[model samples]
Target chain A: MKTIESRSNPLYKQLFKWQSSAGRRDEPILLEGVHLCEAFLALGRQPQYALFDQTRITEPHLAGLIENLSEEVCCLLPAGLLANLSNVDTGQGVLFVVRPAVATLPTHLNANMLWLDRVQDPGNVGTLLRTAAAAGITRVLASTGTASLWSPKVLRSGQGVHFGMHLHEHIDLLAVARTLVVPLIVTTLSEANDLFEVELPVQAAWVFGHEGQGVSQSLIDLAALRIRIDHAQAVDSLNVTAAAAICLFEQRRQHR
Target chain B: MKTIESRSNPLYKQLFKWQSSAGRRDEPILLEGVHLCEAFLALGRQPQYALFDQTRITEPHLAGLIENLSEEVCCLLPAGLLANLSNVDTGQGVLFVVRPAVATLPTHLNANMLWLDRVQDPGNVGTLLRTAAAAGITRVLASTGTASLWSPKVLRSGQGVHFGMHLHEHIDLLAVARTLVVPLIVTTLSEANDLFEVELPVQAAWVFGHEGQGVSQSLIDLAALRIRIDHAQAVDSLNVTAAAAICLFEQRRQHR
Candidate 1:
């Protein structure tokens, strides 16, 4: 194993850029911890590079992982240097730089697509992606205000589901809604129609909005149906991530 | 405005302890950011104390919040001191110390209670609480392995739902389930009954498990019904938070 100790080392600088950059402009996204690295390997996707501290090389599971990697794909850095590259305070001592998947909007429409409008929280965005994948959704359209799908926080929250779906970022949500032939259902707290009472479309696009605001007026007006999950008197709204899961699951249940 | 500059100040130490000690011992939960603090006030609960960065006291919305606070409840800290007390890297420039509500198990619960088994993630635990409240579920019993309900992370995830419910953390789930007169419905991946097909009980306790391990054997054996949310081919399981919302909503739909 080769170890680079200097924080100013070119490799360390690249790792820093990978963690902090908004988009994959010049650097690949960084996947930290062994769980994600194993997920990458299981998918047969070669990471651009793997960096680990020398101490981690002694652990059985990590050592096995390192031995399984192709020589060209592995690199070692000092513990302090690796820590500096981690977004979380406590780094598990392994980080992988992987090329972000080339995501696009689906050309052929399916009845089930998730539209996220200005959903700002990274954890919420990531949880939505996981829910979408669980409900067998294949494509997601994220508007300008939505969190970057490839950011480290979002990637970690998604837990490798990012590699499973088609994710198009910074899209014109209203334009995409207008182009779709399938029924577009938007979730809203103001809607009088309860989700369970409304007949879900066989093939439809589901749109979810920001945490505080429901779907934007432009998108809400474009919707074929406005649905709400009936709630008790105490709560104002469900957490956005929780709402996404419920909406997607309801649609899947109806289609079944 | 009152300014406290010393990091060694007792107020600073207490805030730091509340922020860092999620796993160790029980303490008053810390609520960060202005939005949550505002929500707390709207609910008619007074904070033990509030710390604000002196510079941020000038921002209009924040200034309004400060104005609303009773004079004795507000304490202004130096910008740098406020930065040190904050858990999030970009602090919303306000923090509140509030006593977490003490939650109790319902002795004569007639269904409509939630039993969580070893849900390790604080965010999931919090989201479950919020969903539980929205579904009109007043009682939640968390097994010993479940994340602490009063943890700063869970409290933040619950988004103030803790105050609205009867929450019992660190309990023997199987023993409690055995004592209940209502049917125990446990959610599992291997269940024969699809959640939508089952006649959901209006007054039954719904039990959910960890993300990785389905409900434990003891709890499984205690359950009168085991149910699953059917998904399309290739998808395995839904995230626990999403699963909780769907299950809760389904039960609510059946009763309504």
Candidate 2:
């Protein structure tokens, strides 16, 4: 295994750039910490590189896991360099770089697709992906304004669930909505029809709008049905990610 | 307004410590950026102190908002000092400190309540608060292992929903569960009954467990009903926050 010590090292610089700009630029993501690395390995995805700090590699599980990886997969960095290379508070002495899996939209349309419009938070994007996957919605079309589906934060938030879905990014949601064969279900606070009261089509596209502004008027007009989660009078609405989960789960329930 | 120019300034140092350690320690919390400041003001919550970078106060809305605040509400700081004070990138040139709100649980229990167990992420905890408010669940109880509901991260993530609900933290969940006059509904992937299949009680306590772990075994054993959201075979389960939203919405549907 090769040792990289300098903060000025080209590889270290590349890792930092990748970490900060993974969303804006279409580059391979850097996954930090032991838990994510273990999950990656468990899924049989070979990492391009695995960097570990020598000082913290005392635990048997950590040591054995590093030892078991192919010799070419390992690289040891000085503690300072490893710290500089990771984003999290506790680096867990390990990090890896893997090519982000290309996310594609499913060729065939399903009624249970999720259309994300300008949902910017990476954690929310990731949670929505996990929710969509759980609701058995295989396809997610992320409008250009939405966070990158493959960004490290989203990936970590998704907790490896991205591997199970068809996630398309930088999509024009209006265009997709126009082409869909199924009814478009858009969630809005202003809508009077409670999601439960409305007979959701077994096949429908669930569209979630921006966090603050919500779904655009154009998208709302495009939607065949505008549904709202019934709530008490005190609060306005659920978070977009949470709203997506509720809507998708309810849709799944109807199909079931 | 007074000017705080040095990192060594006692108040500045105290603010920095509060920003970084507020979550871990039960002390003052740091609130940064214009949005949260606006939220705090809208909620009629006063800040202990606010620090502003004159250079970054370019937006009229921000300036106008600040002008409307009491004369003692803020102090201007050198750009470098303000930069040093923030933890996030693009600090937008302002930060402040506030005492954590003492949110109370309702004295009379409602049919619907939100019970959170061992939820560690501050953002998730905040989102749950927002979701609880949106779902119209007036009462929320966070278990001992849950993140601090009043921490800056949770407050920011909650997007002002904390001001809307009866929120409690560090409560004994089992004792609360045992005392609920309404049915205690626990969400778990391992549960035999799908959420939709069960005739969800109109009035019930909804329990969401930790991020990775579902409801605890003891809580599940004590729950009046255990329910699972039926998902497609391809996905495991929804993110805990998302799951909470779904369950709460389902319960809201029953009453409607």
* DockQ of all models, two decimals each: 0.63, 0.63
Those runs of model 1 whose alpha carbons end farther than 4 Å from true positions after fitting are: A1-13, A22-26, A52-60, A63-69, A76-81, A89-93, A106-111, B1-98, B103-106, B232-236
Q: Model 2, range B83-191, lDDT digits (tens) per residue?
A: 7767677787777677766766555566578888898899888888888887777678889989888776788788766665677788888887776788888887674
What is the TM-score of chain A, computed separately for every candidate? 0.93, 0.89
Highest TM-score against the true fold, candidate: 1
Question: Which number leads on lDDT?
Answer: 1
Candidate 2 on A1-256: residue-level lDDT in tens? Answer: 7678787888878878877776554687777667667767777667888888877677775786686578787888888888876777777888888876776565557646888889988988888888887787777888888987887788888777766566778888888778788888888767547778777788788888888899988999888998877766555567788888877777777767
Candidate 2, residue A176: the lDDT equals 77
lDDT of 1 by residue, B1-256 (tens): 4556798877778777777775444476678787778878877788888888888888986887887788788888888877776667888888887876775566777857888999998988988998988889888888888998877688777877777777787888888787888999888877558899988878888888987897998888878999888865434567788888888887877778
What DockQ was computed for model 1?
0.63
TM-score of B chain for each model? Answer: 0.92, 0.89
* Docking quality level of the chain pair in candidate 2: medium
* Residue A234 local lDDT, model 2: 54
Q: How many residue pairs clash in each candidate?
A: 4, 2
